[model samples]
Target: MFAPTINSLVRYYHTFKFSHLDAAIVFFSFFQNMNF
Candidate 1:
């Protein structure tokens, strides 16, 4: 009965995880550029 809700939650979690990683990478690179 709760399968659909669980599936959507997992999907959202993965998407958020990836986007967060991408944002981190971008911020890191920008910071490095500023340091130079």
Candidate 2:
């Protein structure tokens, strides 16, 4: 049913949350390099 979909979404959310900071840093640096 929808349980598997919900579980996968939850896991993906947690992984994204943990990597959020790192992702932001990398994203900003990438843009900065492009701008310069």
Give the top-scoring candidate (TM-score): 1
Stretches of candidate 1 exceeding 4 Å from the true structure: 1-18
Decoy 2 TM-score against native: 0.48
Off by over 4 Å in 2: 1-18
lDDT per residue for candidate 1 within 1-36, as digits (tens), equals 357755654576577765777666755765577689
Task: Report the C-alpha displacement of residue 23, candidate 2, in angstroms.
Answer: 0.2
lDDT of each: 0.63, 0.63
For every candidate structure, what is the RMSD over all alpha carbons to the true structure, in angstroms?
12.8, 10.1
What is the alpha-carbon lDDT for the whole of candidate 1? 0.63
Error of 1 at 13 (Å): 17
Instruction: Write one digit per residue (lDDT tens) for candidate 2, span 6-32.
Output: 576457657777477765675566557
